[model samples]
Target: MASDIIIVGQGICGSLLSWSLLQKGISVKVYDIDADHSATAAASGIINPITGKRFVKSWMVDELFPAADKTYSEISQAIGVHFYEKLPIYKLLESVKEQNDLSARATETGYEQYFTNTDVQYLDKGKVKNEFGSFVINGGGKMDTQLFINSYRTFLKNKGILIEEPFTYEQALVSKSKVIFCNGYKAAQTGFFRDLTWQIVKGEYLLVRIKDFYADRIISGDTTISPTSEKDIYYAGATYQWHYETEAPTEQYKNEIIESLNKMLHVPFEVVYHGAGIRPSAKYRRPFIGFHPEYKHVGIFNGMGTKGISLSPYFAEHFAEHIVNGKELLPEVDVKNILIKS
Candidate 1:
């Protein structure tokens, strides 16, 4: 069946795009090959306003945060799932230089609104050798991606808009008006995007049942500890590697996370679940969203990286506006401008 849009890979990007387009009365058919390690499935969905060693605000946080909050809230109400939670991120500062750098950046960048200077007391301070740190970031939260995906999947199934199998490349038919590639990483093998630099990083996370370290906030260092309602279970992880034998959790990664967590808190926990997925990260780190250089009808809205939860909503809305209203694309993020040069 010919639809207004045929989306490949029902990960966070595809799912959110379908939701956005459908809200505008556009018809979208989604083809998905389920993978346990798909980024959406493995992501902790933390949307931080400030990131990196420099502690600068993320790209377009002021604009993206409001849109993301509204979008997720609307989806939660529509799907009857509690998927958004605003949480305090406790960033560990291990040195005086790091603290000074963060302080200077906050003042120079006018990002002081997002952060404050605070001291954190670690339960297991002896586990690792460190000193004082600060927690100044504001407007950060977590999205329950698993719950959101399950609810949306059910919604799609009920509407008869979801295909559960891998999309066959042989079945794709391109023309002057449109081209459909409905497969996930499988699309990488297709001739259309082979020349594009696509870097896939495999990551792994562990679901642990630790009872002693009970907090409503998220803790980040070498690894992050995200709180869950169960009181005993927390989502901790993940390790990133560009070269790996496969997209599976390794014992080495599992041990690394456990060791990291042990340093954060004084508690014993059992590993309940382990998951891994590959992120479609680009060298430029901006999302790719435009038609192929030669094929105008062939467009893409991928490359969300680790920030998919926060980036996808705004970009999806932007893409929808471009498709439905003939709006001028923003040059800073326009895929055409990035891929094609004058």
Candidate 2:
């Protein structure tokens, strides 16, 4: 019997989407070449409740956070690998204006959840530079992207549903089951969804080992410093380049991250790894989740951008519902609506 669906690309998006469908008793065959430096692997996996220069809550944080927490927890138990961690974010204030802005924003009605206590002072002056003080943000955490993806891939392989190879559109055309492309920025280069407005971004980061510096929480300064599953090794990043010549990691970006680390850390650190990945940001900064307008069987669940870690699980379940039951897709995320607006 033919599988219910064929998922192309086994990144976080693809992994979660297939898992969601499988949990609903739908059979799925996943195709992926497993590139060495994909976007999912390079992600810092930091889920901040607030974002941007204005320090406003992230887009859809209220719904996204709860869904992410529940889904990651469920998947962790299913796979027996603890990958999701709820940790506070220590945001170092860059200037007095920033401190004042946050102080004022904290008094607002809805902002109190993330900024309940801004009086937390930056105490480790000897270890970290704190010329302007900082605050601890609640409802922020990190996901072990590598562990989750790798272990889940293994789980799929054990089930004999994962096919390790390049999947082309021609194969998708001939497939008996519905095919959804979960490929990253590469989707913009080829396939039916190429015409859709794509704001492809290239992000680069560094993996560093800082001796004698212990951080149980995520540190957000000029660059975000997130802990990994490994001891003493942290993921520091990242430089966002809206226009870049290549997806490969450049020395210039590596030095740029090092400079930011120097500004925040008083201690010396060694660069263990440098990586880069291309993000598939949509025109309106939303995801594309639905079937194509013309070719109904060919669908997409890409364009999660930097928020793939938090967005995937929620959206995956949503897309699965749309596929399983006759649920209406949100106008913002519905590809038909998005393409019509564009």
Tens digit of per-residue lDDT, candidate 2, span 275-309: 99888888778898999887788899999987898
What tens digits encode model 1's per-residue C-alpha lDDT throughout 1-342?
355577777888888888888999988788786834468878888989888877777888889988898889898888888888988787777777877776677566457656654334443453333366445456788887777777788888888989887654344444322434423445455645544566777788999987666456777777888876566788997777888997778988888888887776655678999888777776677777766677566667777777889998998888888877888777756667766752
For each candidate in turn, the TM-score is 0.89, 0.96
| Maximum-TM-score candidate | 2
TM-score of model 2 vs. true structure:
0.96
The Cα error of candidate 2 at residue 118, in Å, is: 2.8
Clashes of each: 4, 0
With a 3 Å backbone cut-off (N, CA, C), the pairs that clash in candidate 2 are none
In candidate 2, how many Å is residue 126 off?
0.6
Weakest 10 consecutive residues of candidate 1 by summed lDDT? 175-184
User: Runs in model 1 with CA error above 4 Å?
Assistant: 1-3, 106-109, 116-130, 174-184, 338-342
